[model samples]
Target: MTILVSGKNGQLGHCLVDRLNFSDLDYISLDKKEMDITKYDETARIIGEIKPRVIINTAAYTDVEKSEIDKKDAILANESGPENLSKICKKIDTPLIHISTDYVFDGRSEIPYKPEDDVNPKSFYGMSKLAGEQRIQENCDSYMIIRTSWLFSEYGKNFLKTMLKISKQKKTIDVICDQIGCPTYAGHLADAILKPIKKISENNFDSGIYHYAGDQECSWFEFTNEIFFVANNLGYIEKIPNLNKILAKDFQAKAKRPNYSVLDSSKFCKAFGVNPSNWKESLPDVIKSAVLA
Candidate 1:
């Protein structure tokens, strides 16, 4: 079975490449440079010719701050791209696995967010992603919308890398404590994505909107402190700096993030039999790989 992985240059896409390299299946990885997913005709012409058995879309405009002003890019990549992929995949009778985000929720609830919960996006980024999800559901029958949050990894720019860089430059950093969400590792999410692909040939293949994130939730301040703790233990840092907790109002971000976007991943675990690891437990390995021992 041929699997086409879009957004090969991204953190999740890079991890998927690492996973697919070891697998026995036939696969092709392409970044936006190779395939502009927003171009319907070009995307349709290319993907229709290939006729992949499965199409996993990881391409997205992820800059939360930039999305506030750069609506064009965000909508093109996050909204139109998925729509194009879904339509082409549907035409070719291929299973489409499109990654989504927890930002789709308003983050108003105290409890963890369920897959079927009402979506009320707070930011332009969230709105764009939610639009993508809706478009996929509307156009494609064989589709899986997997939503994740607080993603970090060894590759590409992300919160983990940003915090580590800050620790090197500053003695203290103020992170928003009020904002709470799960920290999903790219490698883990990449692995979980494949489980569905493995079962795509089966008649009982489950496909729908699913939530998959780290087992536990923490504030950005707490997450940064944990990163320091793990980095110190791994000898990446000479000393653990102070992480001062601050409210969201003080930060003044261009985009509005939810206060609590922790997704309830029970449904994803039940279906795939793949439970995500805790954020704290997974921190050490992430630190070890990115930093020199």
Candidate 2:
């Protein structure tokens, strides 16, 4: 049986494909064009035909601000899409490994969020993602919901890439400092997910929500600072932009973000014996790749 991966064009999907290419695993990766999860009949048709042993879903409506304006699209992609996948996975008796976000929490807690923590999402994007998690739990028996935060990589549109682009055009950049979360490297997250695919496929592992992110927590300003620092050290950037620290309240965004959304990954680490990504150590290579790209 093959391992099916969705969102093939996404950063996480790209990373997963890279790892799967070298491994002795038989897998098929599909982008939205091949299999749009939001369409039930289409998704069911494709998945039923493939009959994969395991399905990894990385597709999501991730634009926080855009979600506010395009509520229908966000709900369809984030909630209905997962609902369709869960129902199909259950029908085929295939295990699902779905990616989630830490935005499900309201960020009122001073400590890191646990898998079992109560969720009170403050934004439509967060609410839709939370709804997706619920749909999977209700529809599928064998599923793993991995909630991560602050994803950055050389590929795709993310904070690190945005900062890199802005540094070239502007000498000063203002970033929100009040909000804090772990910075996850997409490549590392893909590795962490792939490590347990065998066990999940064999029904040897537990199925539930898990947290996986960077070990360190920092504000967006700090993350940008580190990005520039790494880029400068690697000679990727001619000059580091002057990063101004601004509070979340001061930032005029359509969506409200959590003040602190750090996730506690002890459960995942203990279960998989894989530590969270060390984004600081991984930043240099990511910057190097982004520069060369």
Each prediction's Cα lDDT score?
0.89, 0.94
Q: lDDT tens digits, residues 1-293, model 2?
A: 59999999999999999999999999999999999999999999999889899999999999999999999999999999999999999998999999999999999999999999999999999999999999999999999999999998888899999999999999889999999999999999999999988999987889899999999999999999999998888888889988889999999999999999999999998999899999999998898887777
Candidate 1 residue lDDT tens string, 162-255: 8998899998889999999999999999988887676873325776899999998999988888899889888899977778889998997999
Model 1 / residue 163 / CA error / Å: 0.5
| Clash totals for all candidate models | 0, 0
> What C-alpha root-mean-square deviation, in Å, does candidate 2 show against the real structure?
0.7
- Considering every candidate listed, which one attains the maximal lDDT? 2
TM-score: which candidate is best? Answer: 2
Model 1 accuracy (lDDT, Cα): 0.89
Q: Model 2 Cα displacement at 179 (Å)?
A: 0.6
Structural similarity to truth (TM-score) of each candidate:
0.97, 0.99
* Candidate 1 accuracy as TM-score: 0.97
